[model samples]
Target chain A: MDICDLGIVDYEDALCFQTDLWRKRVEKKVPDTLIMVEHEPVVTLGRVADESSMIDRELFEKKGISVVSTGRGGNITYHAPGQLVLYPIVDLAEKKRDITFYIDFLEKTAARALNRFGVPAGRDEKRRGVWAGGRKIAFIGIAVKRWVTFHGVAVNINNDTTPFSGMHPCGESDIRVTSAKEVLGRELDMSEVKRVFAERFVEDFGREYSSQFVVRSS
Target chain B: MGKMELRLPEISAGGEDVVITLWHAGEGDYVASGEDLVEVSTDKATFDIPAPCYGVLERMIKKPGEKAKTGEVIAEICTDDI
Candidate 1:
């Protein structure tokens, strides 16, 4: 998989970039790519998200964080400048063609990436994200078009988790959100996290997709 | 001319719940092969099911917000050209 790092982009900018790339991928004009981005502080709501999921709107407004409704599946999520968001644009038709398995793969892949940094993380069966010591560490929400995928996973690396409290993160009101920094008691290097995550993502995909699936790590 | 049934493909072996979230085409609308017909979402992923062949959409069996099952017909397309 090719890797493109658009560092500290606005949410709308990344969305447009991902949309264009997604269409290209669907048309088979481009190879499968992994897009890494750290979005400016923003709260995003999925297509099926209901208004009731939002709470504390003033917190975001006071912080000047923009709220945007997006097309990914899930309820609500917050993204910030330090969050490590990985948007893997893959063609699943040539892959396993299973969205559930794909999502699960994303969660597990994120868990492994976090583990590489000494953060013990794994997927929660009841909730659909990576959890570490009962605190949600990563969020997985994706959108697919014509068997091609976009809008991948987001892991709380060195980001602010305060805005997440404003909305029910992934629609779970009682969920406790944590970051790699909080877990390890030190701020993580963003570039290092990206490198590890890119490596782990490539490794897991290559293992699952067999020899024909060629993916080079960043 | 024949009518083709667009079935919801298997999203997972884990019995993950699927719901039809959006329909891009309506009854009497022409859709090309590979054109998105509807959007279905599982727990954490949303997928757009494309039209299998060029045709006019006859009707939708699964509307937005309705549960979808693997292999169940979600919409019908008439294969006749206008």
Candidate 2:
């Protein structure tokens, strides 16, 4: 896997980038890539995001956050500067070929990275986000095309969590969205966080697991 | 000529509700090999199941909004090749 560092980009432009890469990946033109970015404050709604998942548009509008509908899985979620968004353009057909495993892989990667920060991060299967001290800290939302994957996890390393209050995150009504900064009570350097996360991801995404290993592990 | 069976492959981990979201190829429509035949949602995301071979879509066993299982024949295609 390769890393593409795109500092603070608009969500739509980033999506276009993913689409282009995804097409190339399907065409065997590029290898798997991980794109790390910080997005301008925006709310993205996925396949399961319904009217019930989003209640107050005014909350976003008052804060100048744009809401977008996406093809990725999961529900309404918020993103902004200081949040580390990792979009892994991967080909699962070349690996395990399981959606659930891929999602778990992402959650584990984030959780282990958070552990480095002493955040006590863990996974909640029901809500599908990594939690720390009972507060949701890292979010996972992904999309796969022709067995190639895109649209990935967003970890709250130092981002503002105020916009998350505007919607029911991941369609869960009673959930608290916390950040690494809130959990640690100290601001972190964005570049360092990205570096740690990328390293953890590359490590956890152990290469060439046997087909039996994938079925058994997953 | 052969009738190709189009089944929903194992897209999710296991036991996650997989639903046929939509059909990209209509019945009687000519579909190329590897063309996306349908869109299905599993684990809350959507992915396409491609046609295995160039053929005319002879039947659609699964429709949009219907739950599907892996290896379940979702469609049948009659190939043009001799």
Number of the predicted model whose DockQ against the real structure is largest: 1
In order, what DockQ does each candidate have?
0.75, 0.57
- Per-residue alpha-carbon lDDT of model 2 for A65-147, expressed as tens digits? 88999988778899999999999998888777888878888888899999998889998777688999899988887888789
Please give, as one word, the docking class of candidate 1.
medium
Q: List the residue pairs that clash in candidate 2.
A: none
TM-score of chain B of 1: 0.91
Pairs clashing within candidate 1 = A1-A215
Off by over 4 Å in 1: A211-218
| TM-score to native of every candidate shown | 0.94, 0.90
In model 2, the Cα lDDT at residue B48 comes to: 74
**Candidate 1 C-alpha lDDT tens digits along B1-82:** 6999998887676766699998998899999998788999876778888899998999999889899788888899999754
**Weakest ten-residue segment in model 2 chain B by summed lDDT:** B40-49
State in Å the error of residue B53, model 2: 2.0
- Could you give the interface RMSD of each candidate, to one decimal? 1.3, 1.9
